[model samples]
Target: MTLHCLPSTDITELPATVSNSTENPETQTTAPAEKSAWKTLSGLLPFMAPYRGRVILAGSALLVAAAATLTIPTAFRFLIDRGFSLPANVATDASASATAMADSGIAAGQVNSVFLGLFAVALILALATALRYYCVSWLGDRITADLRQAVYSQVLRQDPVFFETLRTGEVQSRLSSDTTLIQSLIGSSISLGLRNSLLFVGALGLMIWTSPHLASIIVGLLVLVVVPIMVFGRRVRKLSKDSQDKLADTGALANETLNAMSTVQSYVRENMESDRYSQATNAAFDSAIRRNRNRSYLTALAITLIFGIIVFVLWLGAQAVIDGRMSPGLLTQFMLYAALVAGSTGALAEVLGDVQRAAGATERLLELLHAQPAIASGKQSLVASSTADVAGLGARVDFNNVNFSYPSRPGEQALEELSFTIEPGQTVALVGPSGAGKTTVLQLLLRFYDPRSGSISLDNSAIDSLKLNELREAIGFVSQDSVVFSDDVYANLRYGKPDATDEEVRQAASDAQALDFIERLPDGFNTYLGEKGVRLSGGQRQRLSIARALLKNPPLLLLDEATSALDAESERKVQMALERAMSGRTTLVIAHRLATIVNADRILVMDEGRIIESGNHQELLAGNGLYAKLASMQFNAAEFHPAVEAVRVANSPC
Candidate 1:
């Protein structure tokens, strides 16, 4: 079940202070306490600025509609006073009676004319209202679309560090629920508030013109009603923000659980997960109810105070009419204006609530939109070298005394003052225990995270100096946990190269040993892979991932346990394919299985975030270091199936 964007109410005023997520360097600080809700909402002005003409048109139409509505009571006053009141006793005599009948008929015509005039005013109001709604709604849809797009774009540009603190579910909540509140504000609430505000002012003015004393009394009483409502509204805004945050929390919990459904189900924790989700939703529900309760109280109090003033004013008007201080028609007009004022006041109270809620939503979204990623692109781009040039002298990689720590774990280093180098077209393997900084090397090379000290150079140029896109685009990566998008096979392959031809994709798939399985699938290349490629086997998904990288055909390839999922036979076959693919490329392999990297030109055995040994397979074995121990443990162990054993035997001569 999804949480909806709920409109909230207000209580006492509180300071608005929103904190930005830590990963965003620019917006990581808290907003000032004194900032008002209206000021927070003003952030949307940039989104609305492009639609200025439509806003003006809508505003003009609103003004016309309100004016037309106000004119109707004036028409009513004229109809009552002029149409019924006539020459005294004109209908008494025969000839006089005939003259009186003619005069009466003319009066009837005047009444008909007044009714027609009222209809014309009503028609104008309808047209103007329609125009206003169309324009306002169009602006709302357009602005919301732009805002969502802008926020999503900003989200895409964020790096891994950003996601470390801000969960995917929370971001999704802001994108959906928060944007929805802003849409409601722009489409419905703001227009209604403006229209009602105009009506209130116009009605109050006419009331004053009709009876100065009565209007003055109402104006004073309305001030009393408004002051408390404003106080309640501020509190409602804070509660609304709290409620939205709780809803976001529920979304985060559901998202985390759903994404790891297999893990939850495997552990037989369905009921436990359900209970967890239930608690989160209940918390959200409780928050919403609390916010809504305050809103209800405010609503009740507003209606009571506003109508009570209207009743008192009506009583005063009645007295004035009875004392012959006011005419019946004028009293009728005054009463209509008073009713308009009362209705507008009530509506404005609700609009104020909506505005406060939207202000909270706006503040949340602005935090995201204004976020600046700590990892930004550089101005320089990698010069595209020829495939032959790469094959002959592939991209040179050099790391010098680099030290780093994950932003979330600032105290513990993920990589020490380590150093490494790869010559062009060389294949290097890092075989070590888990958390030995093997994958960290690949990530550093990818520039996913920059080192704390020292520099990495690519072909004599600093990787930091190169544009992130260009740097990453020059390397192909396949991780242990292969990621496959929920799309057709052909589309997934084409994702590596958007403009890749069908033949190129098929060739890449064949090279990665994925073509056979892909062909056997229901629709061949067009088969729909389920979310995260759940429709495919572990080995098949890896093959697809490998194919994507092969399609990219970058100067450097990094495979982190790429063949870890394959069966003995599939591993042998893919091993052959990988061998052929690596012939003319610089490659970095992170493997726990020594059999996979037995033929590497060099192997860097790492432990505790530092490389302890580096040499060819034979040299490392002769050195009798961590590499030799690991190789012996693997080759002697029953972990190697016959096909994998053959691969190791063929690549080694002890």
Candidate 2:
């Protein structure tokens, strides 16, 4: 019912939760060796603090229930002693017993009053029990909801790097299974623990009052039972945590493989995945069995010791009654309370087991709650009224002596001393072989990763000074693999511009050349796109992405091989739409298809993270640099239009 992925530690019989943290190198957390497992639950206090009224109400109802349970023994004592005590000499025949009762002068009204009192106690116990359950269950549901929302909100705000170290499925397990354990603890376990604790203490007090000598002996003997339970308590808690970790492992594996079901099926790896999951599941079962066994042993020891002591105490009380040192009614009352104590003490052992299990669950959830994202938005975020009011208003983008390396591959520079400027309304294309750092340039501009040693500015001010949202507002980005959600066509198109009207949506799709295909669907624009747009062709998804960008209509546009996956015909149509939309906008294009950027205002060719050539199509050709080599590979000298244009433009120049 609830959700997020969490990291793991290995236990003796459980599959370890495996993940890579996606946190920025700066905000990564490390747990100290001395940190206790119980400390993890301390984070839950804040979530519960808001509902103190409900918690207090639940606690009060629990106490009342326990008290009502305790009073029942006294009522039973009254009823047995006065209301229905058999005459000592007349039990052999029914008529003789009735005559004996008549001769004993029994009070009819007294019998009714005692019966009524017992009924009142029973009624109070039932009502109190119901109220307690209702209140505690409600709290469990409420806190679980609040907890899920809080954890998810935190996770959503984390940087992508955080997920790089964690799996979504692992978090999913924590959210659903781990939180379910917490709910059980609050709704059933903790309430049971408290009520039983009250009964145990109350019954013990009454037992001492009835027979101090017997109560003292039992109390001393119970220390033996308590010691072993405490010893196994740590082990049980460890196993509980391990069981959860192993379950998370299975969830993560299933999520990972199932999401890539096509790839797995193609490779005929279904059996392999199934076996892996089975192994993980069996390992989890092993841990759970171990935990359950230990808890059972604990419960057995406590109940056996408690009942054994009570049985011995009952014999002593019988002896006292025979000697006339105690009345039969008093001995019966003591026995009832003794049984109550034994039962509640037995329950206390199991409640402690539940606490141990919940502690593990709490520790797991807390790990996520305590994690701080490396890239958090600053409080002084820029407020942009429109795209034009953003920090880099018209998108005169500048990268000044930028040097950077990805955190994952710190040894190799992703970009090195790269400086370039794209003037407003200039269509600049970055042409390079793979690993030329063309994509890195786009990432830096979008602030996906910050440059290590350079200042990036939009318009005139530094980009870091502006809010991430504000900086992103001025740019329309379309990547190679366009993401399409499982939603209607119109919804996907309006993702970038949520406020876009139906007319605006139609115009943007029309501009991106996607309107034709969309209109042909049975439901037209309302047709659903399946997961990752499985219902649509690659070209269609690309066009939808372009439509989304067009809807934004920002001053700056980024095209990262946006047409690379389309067929020739699809590419031609999408390219025409892109050209139409790119006009009058400052566009930075990353293209491997050399022909796409031949007519750009300028093309900067790069290699080894630094620009090697910068010029128009003809200017770079004359230089015979890296740009010319790339051009030659894509276009033959005999028919290359850029080469022809170069000569024509060259000869006509003054």
Give each model's clash number.
Answer: 7, 13
Point to the candidate with the largest TM-score: 1
Worst 10 residues of 1 by lDDT: 1-10
Compared with the true structure, all predictions reach lDDT values of 0.81, 0.76
lDDT of each residue in 37-139, candidate 2, tens digit only = 4475566789889889988888887777777777877777777766567767667687876676676666667677777887887777777777778888888
Clashing pairs in 1: 9-236, 10-232, 10-233, 10-236, 11-231, 11-232, 11-236
Candidate 1 local lDDT, 1-654, one digit each (tens): 001011122232222222111223332324546468889989899999988999999999989988988887777787666665456656565687556656665545666778888888878887888888888888878998999999999989887787776877778878887787788788877988888889889999999998899999999988887788988988888778777776766777788899998899999999999998898778767877888888877778888898899898899889988898987789889988887887777777777878888888888788789887887777775775333344565677888998988887889888888899998889999988888889988988887788899888888788888888988988999999999999999999988888999999999999999999999999999999999999999999999999999999888899999998998878888889998888778899998888788789999988888889999988888899998888778777844577447756765667
In model 2, how large is the Cα lDDT of residue 208? 87
> With candidate 1 superimposed using the best TM-score fit, by how many Å does residue 509's alpha carbon deviate from the native?
0.4
Q: State the displacement of the C-alpha of residue 348, model 2, in Å, after optimal TM-score superposition.
A: 2.6
Off by over 4 Å in 2: 1-38, 84-106, 379-393, 636-654
